[model samples]
Target chain A: MKILIADDSRVMRQIVIRTLRQAGYDDHDIVEAEDGAEALAKVGSESPDLILSDWNMPNMTGIECLEALRAQGSSVPFGFVTSEGSAEMREKAANAGALFLIAKPFTEDTFKEHLDGVIA
Target chain B: MSTTDTGQRRRGSDSRPVITDLMDEDTILAVAGDAWISLVGEDEVLVPIPGEMPGDVLSSWVDVVGPWTGSVVLTTGRATAEALSRALLRESAPEVLDDEDVEDAFGEIANVVGGSIKAALPGPSGLSLPQVGHSPLVRNPADVCRVEVLWRGEPLTISVQGALPPLPVTH
Candidate 1:
């Protein structure tokens, strides 16, 4: 299995990767993109099984990337790992066809709860 | 009649709501405390007891623009920021840290804390990408909610300060 993580901040990407491991989802290949633009490009090249992305980023945003992906007819599973998890953002994410949104300050348990049925 | 339109109005004061009106010091501490444990370490704890900040300080913040326009800022000593960066990096931390590393890690901490603060406020708010440098100037004294904490015996402060200056008193 493979997962692509998109976030502008390298530190945040690393933390997301670490949290994935801590959540016991350790047996997957991971690809990284620095921003939403790169993430859009990588979706073509990498064809990842799932996407874990941050909402805000330089170039394009996570929502834009997700929109682009859907417009392109790519149905790869998608989720948000972001700082903002307000009802507004969550509704936006859901409306955009995201599987889930795991807000920041999350624990391993949070990841497990959200990624369970999606990962398999 | 001249009236500036803020996204929200204070029912009692007939003016725009300030940071203090929306949240308080305890909220700031609680928000920062959660970010610390999640990003820094599970065992890491932020002591709420105020401590004098050192001479060399750095700040990272995210601007919140909405019903309450302001910046959620985290400031600490340069060395302390680097220590936090290392902690965030964990096994990937390089032996020698660079400015970008500190900026990415420290700025992200501000981003998370700021994001939570924004959610707690009356939103439909937009959050800016994190920035790192000296702290932004406080435009309104009474519009700020600040919390001082000691993290690993080093002083750190989280301030949610309004972007606008105080409104002129009207009769």
Candidate 2:
């Protein structure tokens, strides 16, 4: 499976990639996008199996990208890897069709717990 | 009332709880401690003690706009910021660090810390992208909740300062 990680901060993108490896999901191919607009563009070109995106980003937000994808009739599995995990954001993400949210300061275990069933 | 015309009915400042009313120093410290363990390292722990800041320092922060608007700022010496960037990058860290690398890494720390702090606040707030530079000035001293901690024996400060000036004192 291929995973596309979108975050404006390069440091955060690298950390997500690192945590994925630490979670033992190292076999999948990885793609990176700097912001939500790039993420939206990549969805067309990359056709990733999974998308892990940050909530607050330049250009487009993760939720906006998700809505756009659904509007375009794309059903790619989406999740958020963001700093905030408030009930409101989670509800917003889920209503927009997010699979799950992994808050920041996450651990390998957190990734594994969220990805096991999702990732083949 | 805040959005109404004439600006006659100002939102009573008393109704909007300040940072101290919502959170205290210990809570901020706990949040920062968790971030340190995750990003900096597992064994790394922040010492809850105040230290005199050095003359030259750098700050990274993210603004929280909502019921209680403020910025979650992290300030430390330039050297310490570089050290943190290296630690965050670990094996991927370049030997020679550039200004951009420090800003990106250090700013991310603020992002995470700020995000967590936002969640702890009252609600439905918007967080701005992380910024790296001199800290935003404290607009309302009473609205600020500051915590000083030592990371790796270096002084660091996490300040949750209000973005707006104190509401007009109703006589």
Candidate 3:
């Protein structure tokens, strides 16, 4: 499976990729996008199996990209890996068709808990 | 209604809750502690004891905009910030660290801590991208909640300070 990780911070992108390996999901192909707009563009071009995106970004936000994807009649599985994880944000993500949200400062176990079923 | 009563209503309308009203030092410490364990290391713990900050310091922060507008800032000695960056990068750390590496890694720490802080506050708030440099000035003394802690024997401060000045008193 292919995974698209979208975040403006390159360090965070590296962390997410490293955490994926730590969680034992090292076999899949990984794609990178700097912001939500890039993620949106890559979604059309790369056709990733799943997307893990940061909520806030320059140019466009993850939520905006998700909304746009739904409006375009796309059903790609999407999730958020962000610093903001309030109940309201979680509900907003859910209502927008996100699979799940993994809050930042996450451990390998946290990644495994969320990705075990989704990865396969 | 009396004229004085009308003025009271206006003051009430302008009243905004400060950082202490929403969250306290303990909560900020807890948030920072959890972030440290996850990002720094499992065994790494932040001691709550305060220490004097060195003259040479670096700060990283993210602005939170909502009912409670402020920035979640982390300030520490430059060496400590570099140490933190190295710990975060682990094997990925270049033999010689660059300014960009420290800024990116340190900014991310603020991002995580600020994100967690935002969640604890009232809903629908926006989080800004993290920045690294001098700390932002505290707009209102009463609008701040700061916690000082020690990580690896180095002093670090986490300050949640308001972006706006205190509401004018309608006396």
Best by lDDT: 1
Which 10-residue window of candidate 1 chain A scores lowest in summed lDDT?
A111-120
State fnat for each of the candidate structures. 0.88, 0.84, 0.77
Best by TM-score: 1
Q: All candidates: CA RMSD in angstroms?
A: 3.4, 3.9, 2.1
lDDT of 1 by residue, B1-171 (tens): 778868476564476898988998888888888999999999999999889888999999999999899999999999999999999999999999999999999999999999999989998999999999999999999988898899999999999999999999875
Model 2 TM-score on a 0 to 1 scale: 0.94
**Cα deviation of B140 in candidate 3 (Å)?**
1.4
Query: What's the iRMSD of model 3?
Result: 1.1
Q: Score the docking of each candidate (DockQ).
A: 0.91, 0.81, 0.76
**Clash pairs detected, candidate 3:** none
Candidate 2 interface RMSD, angstroms, 1 decimal: 0.8
lDDT of 1 by residue, A1-120 (tens): 889999999999999999999999999999999989999999999989999999999899999999999999999999999999999999999999999999998999999999998887
lDDT of 2 by residue, A18-101 (tens): 999999999999999988899999999999999999998889998899999999999999999999899999999999999999
Docking class of 2: high
